[model samples]
Target: MTGPPNSPTLLREMSERIRALGELPQTSEARAEVEAALGSKWWGLRVLAIAVIGAWRDKAWLVERALRAENGMAGGRFGHARTQSWRDLEAQTAAKAAVPMLDPADAGWLLDRWFSDEPLAFAFYEYVGLRLDPTAVERRVAEEFARRRSQQRRLPLFRLLRLRRGVADRDARLRRLAQGGDETALLARDLLSMEARFRDRQAQTPGGAKRAKVSAGAARRAAAAEALAESRRRAGRKGRR
Candidate 1:
């Protein structure tokens, strides 16, 4: 089907409808309006429709519709493909945002799609990990971790490891890596340290907490920079020696 008209009037009307949807209860009729909006030819309108529906009702069917709508976009060339990837990422993000309302089985289905190596699937997997039961996906996570780690390009593996570490509270492993002077681990450590200090300050000064929090954040950034510089200096000295 031909897409909706890319006109200011259509944009204004959709915006008004979305705003109205926010005011009303999430009912089947309201959801149908959102589904109609998803059928718009304009990518931006489709994105807005997904956002509105995902925000209002966290239904799996709506999530699936958003994914399908994104996939319907035609990619004509390299540049078009890149734009399609971005749009797909947006829709995947919207779908993942509704994970809290998804059943465990549906969440697992989403997780399995990550294995397909489709565009934006990894990003969706990351979001799904935050909500799904860790035990249910442990085996898949381990396999993914090993597969990514075996590759020479290790950034993706590191990210997966970091997420797993955070979810599992693998503090000892993080501490060991920090001690071994891994830059990312050190950064994580610095952030955690700053957070603890910030919490303490907030507890001590509930009235001026906003200013204290800002100061604490600035201090954390400065300290992180100094720590990174020190590490570089140490590496340089060791190299020279």
Candidate 2:
């Protein structure tokens, strides 16, 4: 019987099922339910099932199985036709789930994949690798920085800026990035400009302070964006990739 669009019952039932999967006795029956959910017609169900698989993998019997399953699922191109498939979300989920278990070699492999993978998952694989071990990834980025082309360097630079979580380091990192001559640098410049404008806005004396600085930054940022676009066009890319 169909319930009214996402009725309370469905939500509660789904939540209970997920919780059950996490709490179950690690029986074959529970494993079967997990597999069945993976094969469901509803994508949301499949995603939740995958997440549940991650959630409960610490149980003794499930440890290896969950690892293998997530690796397999991460490799799939599964989705219905005439609709968009989010390759990144589930990949990200699996990546996050697996971080605690990663060895140095595994983290290294992920960094290489993040750099070379055709369809990247938000550069978050880079994030995951770094989160696993910041020094290793940072070393790789520095070693590879000058060798990679502009498009190639963008994400790594962006990720570097992100990994600097300390306020002083973040500010310094932003300034350093904003001065570079790449797409990532353009983004950093825009971000710094935006932050400045936001501060000026808080003063409310914002009349002259905000206008002149914002306009100058706006024009520069716009030009930087167009230049980046033209570079892409020259490279035969119209953005969607």
In terms of lDDT, which candidate is strongest?
A: 1
**Candidate 2: tens digits of C-alpha lDDT, residues 53-150:** 76765433233333343344455644433223433455555545544555666666566655563343433354453455656765776666668766
lDDT of each: 0.56, 0.55
- Give the alpha carbon lDDT tens digit for every residue of 110-221 in model 1: 6556454334333455565465565555455545545653222123223333343242353343344445454444544654554456556665875656665556435444
Question: Best candidate, TM-score-wise?
Answer: 2
- TM-scores of the candidates are 0.48, 0.51
What does the lDDT come to for candidate 1?
0.56
Candidate 2 runs further than 4 Å off: 1-19, 58-96, 100-105, 117-130, 149-155, 162-167, 170-241
Which pairs of residues clash in candidate 1, taking residues 3 or more apart in a chain or in different chains? 3-41, 4-41
Worst 10 residues of 1 by lDDT: 149-158
